[model samples]
Target: MTAPTLRGAAAFVQQVRAAEQHLSGADPVMAAVIERHGPCTLGATRRDPFHTLCASIISQQLSSKAADTIQARLMAGIGAGRRITPPLLLAASHEELRGYGLSTAKARWLRALGEAAAAGTLDFRALGRLDDEAAIAVLDALPGIGRWTAEMFLMFALNRIDLFAMDDVGLRRGVAMLYNRGRPLSDARTLKITRRWAPYRTIASWYLWRVADPVNEIWV
Candidate 1:
């Protein structure tokens, strides 16, 4: 398959610069993180909504390696292609999907997602036009999708720049390390701290994720 074009090249760089400046000035802890991490290189990999959401489901609660294994099996089961569309996923049986290493519940969720896509109940095209809240609502309304997952879709799929996923464990842990001196902060406190990130919280969140796992490569 042709390589997917990188989304929002000039705009993403500008946002990264703006976010780094704001974050560095607003909080010394974040400023240090910025200094260490240098320029934010996070950018959305071009993916259709269906495959992105499906991949998110596959990734839930699994280590990156494990998730990649399951996803590879799933793709091989469906067909030998980088893209996994709703029609292709729907063509597979539940047992077949389960054999691809998905838990039964996740297999069901994938099927439900496929059905929704097939029926036009979840309009991929329309989602791009909706604002963050509305788009999140649409994603969260699907079976097995939650706020975190929806927010991930926003950051990694839609490339929305302002999202701060308050419930992300890595973000919270990173915040604690950077701001709270290695103590986990309450969700309320986390949100309060992240408020300064504003308009560029997604970029900040990427740095925090990096802080949380310095050895692991972060994928968006």
Candidate 2:
């Protein structure tokens, strides 16, 4: 697959700088974040869609380091230095997968994903062709997947250019700090504030993640 670019990031900053000079509700906090962080971009791993989705599941609510460790263990068990395949995962029993450090829920989710892939129900190729809404709808139809998981699939796996996670705690907290607020910003409020960004919200979202998570900035 061709690599995605952050051309949107640079353009959004230019637009924001121009808009803030005239607009009343432009996020000055976001402006300051761009100024401090320089230009941000999509830093997604170059993995296949299925693997990326699996990685996203592993990452849910876990620290990045912990997720990586668990994923490494699972992968090593599934395929010895080979690609992650549905057949390989299905070959392992539930207890075997759980022994690799997956919670009961995550192990079930992984099994369902593998079953879907094997049955041709979860078409990664078709998912690649889907727009943001369609992709989310398809993924979230599965058990154990929700809106946040679907959004992560869009942002990281499909590399959708126009998406953002309003519910992201890091982004909200970062926005609060950048704006000199004492409390975390609410998702509803953040969504309202991000309107000026429009189609470039994904780029803005990247900046928020970076600002909100400095220790993990290396990943951004």
The best candidate by lDDT is: 1
Residue 182 displacement in candidate 1 (angstroms) = 1.2
In candidate 1, stretches whose alpha carbon ends up further than 4 angstroms from where it belongs are 1-8
- What TM-score quantifies how close candidate 1 is to the native fold? 0.91
Question: Superposing all C-alpha atoms, what RMSD in Å does each candidate have to the true structure?
Answer: 3.1, 4.5
Task: Kindly give the number of clashing pairs for every candidate.
Answer: 0, 0
Global lDDT of each candidate: 0.85, 0.71
Specify the poorest-scoring 10-residue window by lDDT in model 1.
1-10
Q: Total clashes, candidate 1?
A: 0
lDDT of 1 by residue, 1-220 (tens): 1112454566666766888898899888889988998787766356577888998999999998999999999999899498788888999999999999999999999999999999999987788889899999999999989999999888887777889988888888899998889998888888889898887888899999989998877454
Q: Which residues of candidate 2, in runs, are more than 4 Å off?
A: 1-28, 80-83, 217-219
Residue 64 in candidate 1, Cα distance off native in Å: 1.7
